[model samples]
Target: MPVDSTGHAIVAEGLRKRYGGTEALAGFDLAVPKGTVCGLLGPNGAGKTTAVRVLTTLLRPDAGRAEVAGFDVVRQAARARYHVGLVGQHAALDEVLSGRQNLVMFGRLYHLGLARARRRADELLERFGLADTGAKPVKQYSGGMRRRLDLAAGLILAPSVLFLDEPTTGLDPRGRNEVWEAVGSLVAAGTTVLLTTQYLEEADRLAAKICVVDSGRVIAEGTPGELKGAIGGDRVDVVLRAADEIPAAMAIIGRVTGGEPESDPDTRRVGAPVRERVAALTEVVRALDEAGIVAEDITLRRPSLDEVFLRLTGHRTDERAGERAAEEVAA
Candidate 1:
């Protein structure tokens, strides 16, 4: 049955693809709403890149169906390609070309006329905050600047759907921040983006929704907060001034949180999942004060994405998800 793609910028249903014995994508399904960023997260060999390839019309799927920008990826590949842009793990700019020249070249390649290309080049340079340094060769640009230029090139056609495969793989914190701002601006302007990244922090920051892929299928999907809350809602922890207070502290915390409390004598810490985080913390503190249990520290915190990924996928996100070429080739 065909799934309606009326309001989705990207849709995939039971999408399957195999490379020899490797099942790159097995019954994968996804739906990304229009004008939003959908983060695709997976460990290596999890079919993240293969799915992107099929959705962007780069590779044909062996089975199932997908649609991008309201066009069937298989039956209407050309139309889908026209309305989409792709930025891979690495920068695709020519080092010798100035940022302005590179964007102009991209515009021309997209078949814009010389005048139109030049105009578009200037427009992108200004839009990405590269206008002041547009004349500098890409080789002279900083890592962040080069990435911003790559992003600008991807937008040369003003694509309605953009696929980013780890757009900040090697960038330092500052460079990554710059690219993050650029991506935010694109979504603000109504472009739908599908971002595949290993950086949980990146997805947590940029994606309105996240899908966790494992074994070539989506094992989990939700907003960052929702996903984090899935494992355990919120936790209250207390570090007692004396390790001997563990038993008493656990009883107090368990009563307030209404959950079993665990204690670590070595760390002098007692922790438990809490329903009402602030209120529970307050109640626990008052209880401890009345019991004359000296407390060194008390805090409430939610589960991190890393913990969620581990709990769901049974492994942490490999930092080496960058080796896509080999993975896709095997796929």
Candidate 2:
């Protein structure tokens, strides 16, 4: 299938899917432009993986329509498959096979000639920085190496769009960073990527735009900064030297920021959203000094993606991840 002239690598509307009594996807919608990364962020059972399956033609939606690389997912499933690659949560590789052998096998499975398959395998091994370790058995590879090999397998045909569903799950920080760098390199060469991740920081770093999914619907969509700004601009936090000073500090913060302040009594910390970032911090400091209150620390900073997610969804991404029966059904 050729790339879509509309410049959207993937598009979906009113997608609905159900597993038994659970509605995995309810009126889900998405549009991802070519040559960019779009992130789907949500807790378990929010329909992220279900949406990916439908778009990739692995699972059919009960209703609605979608297109990938100019082909309708349902009407032209084969053609759609030709233009997209999927790296699922679990590794889909033969542990007994070497990394290079695995990629070569994938190429041959796609009907590339043996010589062409070997060439593509070598190319990908070098491209993903696994040239030296390409001959090592996948079972002996590090977590990051196995994942990079999985990514290489997904790119045997140089797909136009790639769907990554929690690609870095269970990886250590170093392994995760290695995958992130590889992904960045791919995007630089103009591959459209749709990433679904529970890691807010991953989404923030990789996604050009983010869709916050909850209850099978997108409750918010924007760039990371825009999403953070949607809830509140910047925040001022002050830790008092003594627990008894929290009340006075909250009052000072409230007066300076002109917003209601929240306090953690146990930590003796008071914080509030402030529109004027630096000015509010300065005023709070001056007010505390005038009131003869000592502050252990004071700082003003933009809200984190985690804070934005909590504010929008009222829960963390990891919360209920293992408890969602609907997710189990979808899986």
Candidate No. with top TM-score? 2
Q: Model 2: how far is 86 from its true place, Å?
A: 1.1
Q: TM-score, each model?
A: 0.80, 0.85
Where in model 1 is the C-alpha error above 4 Å? 19-21, 233-254, 259-302, 313-331
The top-ranked prediction according to lDDT is 1
Q: Taking the tens digit of each residue's C-alpha lDDT, what string does model 1 give over 1-331? A: 5677888999999999999999999999999999999999876678898999999899999999999999999999987878999988888999999999999998998899999999999999998899999999999999999889999999999999999988987787789889999999889999999999765668888999999887788999999788766766667889999998889888888887888788889999998878787888889999999999999999776544444555786776554553432232222
Estimate the Cα RMSD of every predicted model relative to the unseen true structure. 5.7, 5.2
Q: What is the lDDT of candidate 2?
A: 0.85
Clashes of each: 0, 0
lDDT of 2 by residue, 1-331 (tens): 3334497988888889989999998998888899999999877778999999999999999998889988999999998887999999988999999999999999998899999999999999999999999999999999988899999999999999999999888787788889999999899989999999875668888999999888777789999778766777678889888998887788778988888798999888898988878888889989999999998998775554455566897776554553332232222
Candidate 1, residue 205: CA error in Å? 3.2
lDDT of 2 at 200: 62
